[model samples]
Target: MSTPAPHAAPLVLVTGASGYIGGRLVPALLDAGFRVRAMARHADRLQDRPWRDRVEVVEADVQDPASLEAALDGVDVAYYLIHAMGGGRSFADRDRQGARSFADASARAGVGRIVYLGGIHPDGEELSTHMASRKEVGDILLAGAVPAVVLRAAVILGSGSASFEIMRHLAERLPVMIAPQWLRNRIQPIAVRDVLHYLVGAARLDGAPNRTFDVGGPDVLTFAELLQAYARAAGLPQRRILTVPVLTPRLASHWIGLVTPVPTGIARPLVESLIHESVAAEADLRALIPAPEGGLTSVDRAIELALARVRELDVATAWHSATPAGAPSSPLPEDPEWSGGIVRGDERQRPVDASPETLWAVLEGIGGRRGWYSWRLGWISRGLMDRLVGGPGLRRGRRHPDKLAVGDALDWWRVERLERGRLLRLRAEMRVPGQAWLELGVQEADDGGSILHQRAIYHPHGLLGDLYWWAVWPFHEIVFGGMQRNIARAAEAAPPDSRRAVNTDTDTDTDTEETA
Candidate 1:
């Protein structure tokens, strides 16, 4: 196969690349061989994005006319995806100002074309402030000398996206819904992926300047119908949605905020936009992009994809643990300037028929160069991840080969206290939802075998913390049990003198194992 020649695909400037819609569009541009200049208020916020490294980052605010000059410099095509839906009260004015500034900048910069995404509403209907703002932005972009293509869409459904989050919250929490008149209002929700396809396609189009197209999925269901469909997709019982014409948009916004994870400020605009049907009127978007590309995703599929994306982010990302005792409890553990909460007195124990020397050796060599004995790979992998997120990795070995001191770094934990061959207490330095600790203590038993006790404890933060704790409980059970068993085995494998002599002045032995 002959490799295609890399022609100049145009330097495209994507505003709001740090936002939900714009965030997903950047990678598509990169994949299509376009030179991209990503614009965002805080470039660092977009650091974790997949296309972060593939484009030039320009720090610019759309509302600032001066900022737009530098942002539009050397840009052939610009995507105006910025929307201020989160800010309070005057968000509509802010949106208009930003759009106007960008339009002026694009014209002055002599940009060939501008592609914008706006909200769609049925023509001839009274529009809400949110919808009006969207229309105003489109109008502003159109006024620019450069040809601008506006693709107006409605209620984008994708995980982490606002509408999808609202749907998720409502479906997940409310079994029976008492909807307002707006609930019966029909809408054409677009899949985020489909929306991106159109945006990417519009970027490369040759003709048509100052044209606006309505964009949406094939499904043109009412708000209530969509809710039912989403509920069904989630495997929940068919929820009854009773629509009452008496409830107004203002009340709907408050109700939505109470039900969904979205704040009232965001939900208010979204509910207001629902006053009119948002089905696509023009089929030009589909004509520009064909079949598979043009095809509108099913609401169920869109909902599933959105939910899956949120899950992936949640599971993969780790929130840093809070500090304890005026000391930073982070795995790095250098400064004691702790910023998180403190945990104390959470403990458990077990006993083994082994001497203090043997037990201590087992504990010190527990991880790193020494395998965890069983499920060791799992432990190491998690430890590495912790280290990557500024937590301690397995690189930090124990202080003494077989002996531990107070405040010695061991893998991802610190030895808080050690009493010769008798007891060893460790405070977890790894970042977790809550504080964690591991304590091992040995004592001489009456039966000539030493008692070895090992236990792990955790304190959860809030609702998320509780969920996190339960979700990982199964893994914890396996790892903690394996760790306890290995310690006993390591002690048994050691020489008889070591097992018999505890500090050489100790005698007797017995065994006990307990966990919580």
Candidate 2:
């Protein structure tokens, strides 16, 4: 018998590869024997993905027609997952323009098909800006020369999804709630896994016509019932929801922003979409593509899977996966004078009687339940203030207690860069007047020991930012100074066998969940 010869796999271009859905879809496409080209506006944003090296990455913005044309070249299928919700008030216009550019470019590139994931909305009813834009984008794609499959979904339930995050935080933080009347509006929520399954399956629908298909889970329930279901799945007490006719969508979004990591800009659109019922009107997609192995996921099962991922620290992507458009992305300059801005820093260094490996171990395990090395009360106070102002605060916590990768959220700080056993740089997600970063590094010393270096870097925005830095500088001695000293002391005090034990436990400790 002759062995079959391998052939080139069909190439699929995934825009918005840095987002929650696109990030997870890349690995799924690869598993399904498709060649994936992960496209992002900034290619470096995808550098830290676990499958970064597996897929070909292209830097392209959908609004930039030239870049889209180049990115869509030689693509059998293109996934339109990009949206401009974080771009401010003109987001709908931007979404419209981007869809037009992408549709034209895909046709010029001779792409086989286009797959789009859009929000499920009722027909013949006035839609929110978010849902209307989604529907328009789908329409633009379906009208193009290339065949398109638009899978419309309601609330996508997953650990790191925005909808799931909003629901989780509301249920966890509020035992009794004064909510909007939209809580009674019916919705057919779908699991993120099911959405991804349908998306991947769309690629193989060779002769399917270009049209929209409604996709949803096995259960249909109201927002109130969903919250109650989430509480039950998370092992929490029953929640009392008091719906008031006075609470408007804008007010509800602000309330959500204050409690969850999601901000008002993104939350408002989501809130508006929930003002009406969003039950799926048709299940035509299931006829073309079969459901996953066990059939559609139930609401309870989806919540369980999401909670399990959070507990196990195995979330693949988060709503925060994409950096905010206005947030600082530049690296810390070597010299403050060269930055062309006022840069204030709190720097501390300490010599330790421990190996570099031991110091790295302590540094990697700094946040989450382990807590900051010093000034716990001060940190808590600041975190609470941030939360009140619609910030991530400290509740987001580190993804893993013992190990961290770049982009992992660590108590309102994001891991910006990681050089194994050498350097770890964290960018702040907390609400502040300006941008901030905390960098921790370890190096070998001449005395057969390690030297720990810690720095808190801040770039002020205006007069207020500068004043804020000066106000906080007085406490740096207790905060930054003690943090460095305590970290060094921890490395020195740790047992010689603890370094290996930490690494081993990262793989074996799947059941132990860390608290804020």
Candidate 3:
């Protein structure tokens, strides 16, 4: 493949662009005045991102050499943020293979630099499978022909980070608990903002050698102390934690899986990594790349900022953004009728005594603290069931109270499509036997009012999926029917001024009323 024409700014390729770090890094690189090309296995996943229009998006998989080579073409720097943490027992081997492919592709493309984010591990000690895999990937990149910068960090504290979410839920849910012995292991956590700072700076380095750099925040604390700090930041009472020796990482992972929204597959590796101290061994990188403005974020301040972002409904990217619920090739509801397999749906339309704008406002603000505008008990029961089965459940919540962007998480649903004042389509993230979506729309009626349309679409996998659909088919009335009625009622009752204030822009709107 031929290289694309160069821009005034250096072109940067960000692999895993839909992932937490990659998603956040793209905008940061753009803000730093670099032309960015975002690569993902499914380019459609990047379509909904707010920065989708600004960056060049290419569908590429690291495991595919040709795809990697094509993606790295015309790239000055490439950020390798891909990982296979939850891909079962062969994850490490897969990681190694992908890293090797990426390295070879970068060298062939003549990419100047490759920046990789890896976990921090104690030197000369046996590391957990997770940490070992990270180190191996870093080693592969550094040993390659291209100059690479490997940044090793531990416990990235952010609103939607896996580590932060695990800590947050544990601190909030269990005031008194029997914890694992590793809770007392010392760790040097860094804020996601600082990690981004160093990442952006690494791209501009004049002649940095290919080496691994340990990056961490100022404070060093044990996991127990970190939990206490989290409790303090969240205004919770001091937690009573009793450490016991019998609880192994495997056992603790199951316990954490039940307590937090993080699944056992991803939690096991994290729990194992916590068994070792992860304090930075050196600060050599500081001499090359300067610290962020002010200084390295303190632990307390990091926790506070993360909590504030959650409360204010301003989380930029979530841990699950990288792994969207359904398959990318799955046919959308809007696709041609003859496109996909056995599809089932529950469709409802109601003429409302409200304007299209009023109905749209109610539709936009359906999830999060506003509730589902339907059977409250049923929604809660279903969310709980989903949680028990290791799904996101309803805890993910919406990013904003009044307005939603396309990729925003609304409870167990992801905002797949959004048309301001017209339609909102949500894809189910809750664990189910089949792929599903919920769509809400507003249309002007002939009688100077509005018409509300609601749909629940599901695409079954096999006999099990078909059976699952029929089993829940009986409750459609109580769930879907009630939702339709309640949403129309909410639109009719909304204040006139409140209906006019619905803004679809991603900016925080101070004028909008805080919906409950």
| Tens-digit lDDT string for candidate 3 (1-516) | 356564478889999888889999999999999999999887866786889999999999887788877788888899999888666678888899999999999999999999999988999999988889999999999999999999999999998888998898899889999998889999999999999999999999988579999999999999999999999998999999999989998888878877776766678889999999999999988999889889999999999999988777677877767764223334575678637578899999999998888888878877665677767777877877886766766666655677776656677787777888998888887778888999999899999899998999998879999999999999999989988888877777777525532322222211111211
The per-prediction CA RMSD against the true structure, in angstroms, equals: 15.2, 4.6, 4.6
lDDT of 2 by residue, 1-516 (tens): 112136778899999898889999999999999999999887866787889999999999887899887788888889999877655677878888899999999988889899999998999999987889889999999998888999899999998888998898889889999998889999999999999999999999959579999999999999999999999999999999999899988888888877776677678888998998989999988888999999999999999999998878788887777665445666775555445788889888889999898889989987766677777778877877876766666666655667777656777788888897999999997878988999999999998889999989998889999999999989999989878877877787788625631322112111112421
TM-score of each model, paired residue for residue:
0.61, 0.89, 0.89
Candidate 3: regions farther than 4 A off: 1-7, 42-53, 324-329, 333-340, 497-516
TM-score of 2: 0.89
lDDT comparing candidate 3 with the true structure: 0.83
Off by over 4 Å in 2: 1-6, 334-339, 500-516
For residues 1-516, could you state the per-residue lDDT of candidate 1 as single tens digits? Answer: 112235766888998775556766788888878889998765544554556678889888876789888778878889997776635567778888888888888888878899999888778887887788889889888877889999998888866565765676677678887888677878899887888888888887867557898888888898788778888877888887778888888777766654543445557788888888777888786766664543568998888776665544331111111111123333312225433643323233556776666676666545434545556567657765664444444534432333343444555666655665666667776668776777777777776677667666565677676776777777765777666666677677778645331221111111000000
Note the Cα lDDT for every prediction shown: 0.67, 0.83, 0.83
Q: Which residue pairs show backbone clashes in model 2?
A: none
Misplaced by over 4 Å in model 1 are 1-6, 312-516
How many times do residue backbones clash in model 1?
A: 15
